[model samples]
Target: MTTMRQLKKRAQFLKAARGRKIVRRGFVLQAVAHNEDCDLGPALGYTVTKRVGNAPQRNRIKRRLRALSKEFAEKFDPNFNYVLIGRQEALHEPFNELKKNLARALEKIHVERSAASHAIDRKSKS
Candidate 1:
């Protein structure tokens, strides 16, 4: 249920810093992130390369990721733009597992980013 309004665009994706987090089964989840440009809220983006599959396959994976994003948006900080890149194996994964993987990846990102922000705030407060 992730809406288009919550999504970041291609330019933003290219401008973001990125990292990879390994998930269960050694699947690598890639993310490119930028701070939320405005105070409105957190926004997210997704990309499925044709290398992952053909047109239909890419769309299917995009759909799965979108659903997962919507389902877990509450867990994310609304001050950053995030783009998720899907792999070919993602196509074969069951919906539940896909959801779980997405959740795990997002959780790791959230915790890491939150800790980093907290430390920065503490430093600035000193």
Candidate 2:
């Protein structure tokens, strides 16, 4: 399994927000796959904004998201930086369901990425 790193800088999370994203029941997942120049494994950031809840509530939401993200760490692309935005429902959602959602989101991200790459290649060939 590839090593996992925490995304500490605000800029790193902001960068990932510009990438492909998938909305799941418990969270919004955004990912940007890195180029060959980056050799590190997947880096993750978890955030629950003030709009979501108070400090304690937001902290709880972030904790759940962290656990779910860790459980499905291998599902994430090794070369990508990911940000998981916690949702209110995340507090009450079943743990297993959250895991499934994460897996599904990862699969969708890969599909969309591959399609985009293929289109870019075709455009360059023309």
Candidate 3:
């Protein structure tokens, strides 16, 4: 039952860009393991730029992304920071499909991260 912190700083978003990324039909998800040790859950950020649409459309996309984050918050690792970048299709995409894609994205990110860490461990042991 961990609550997520909002990622508000510019640097926080930039840092997350260096981590694993999953692109979906409606959005792109980026996750980076946090360096600082803290009790708070994963930090989350949402972005829907002018490239997607006008102010109203962008707002709609952001709203959907906010809901998506809340629904999938538990799916993310507690030590990671995540950013969801909304696409133009997000405005018209079905909610259920969006959720499905997000779930898949989360699974891929988790798998990739674990594999990377395992590789590092193997390298150190060699």
Candidate 4:
């Protein structure tokens, strides 16, 4: 089982927020390439706003996100930093469903990234 590197700084989370964002029912996933440290593997950060719930409820959302991160660690791109913003729905959602959503979200992020790069390549060639 691979353990993901944890993002500890506020700056790290904020930087990811400026990158690609994928919104799902359970949570929001933000990902950005960290060119400075690609060899460290993917780093993960979790945040739950007060609007979602009180202290205990927010903590539960973070816990569920941690589990999902662990299960999909290898699927994450090593060069990217990711932040997961927990939503209120996360607390009531089934674990299996959350897992499926996460998988789909990751796939979508990479696909979009590749498509964007292809567009850039075409522009440079013209």
Residue 12 alpha-carbon offset, candidate 3, angstroms: 0.5
Give the per-residue lDDT digits (tens) of candidate 3, residues 46-110.
Answer: 99888888999999999999998889877878889999999999999999999999999999999
**TM-score of decoy 4:** 0.96
How badly does each model clash, as a count of residue pairs? 2, 0, 0, 0
lDDT of each: 0.65, 0.88, 0.90, 0.94
Residue 83 lDDT, candidate 3, scale 0-100 = 95
- Tell me, by TM-score, which candidate is best: 4
**lDDT for each residue of candidate 1 in 1-126, tens digit (9 for 90 to 100):** 323344546576665435434454413544445454545656666777767778999888788777767787676555556666767777788878877876787788778877988999999999
Q: Estimate each model's TM-score.
A: 0.72, 0.91, 0.95, 0.96
Best by lDDT: 4
Query: Weakest 10 consecutive residues, lDDT, candidate 4?
Result: 33-42
Question: By the lDDT metric, which is better: model 3 or model 4?
Answer: 4
Q: What's the lDDT for residue 68 in model 1? A: 69
Candidate 2: which stretches are off by over 4 Å?
A: 35-39
> How much lDDT does candidate 2 score?
0.88
Predicted candidate 4 versus true structure: per-residue lDDT over 21-104, tens digit per residue: 999999999999997667678899999999998999999999999999998999999889999999999999999999999999
Error of 2 at 40 (Å): 2.7
- Return the candidate ranking by TM-score, descending: 4, 3, 2, 1
Worst 10 residues of 2 by lDDT: 33-42
Model 4 global lDDT (CA atoms, 0 to 1)? 0.94
Better of 2 and 3 by lDDT: 3
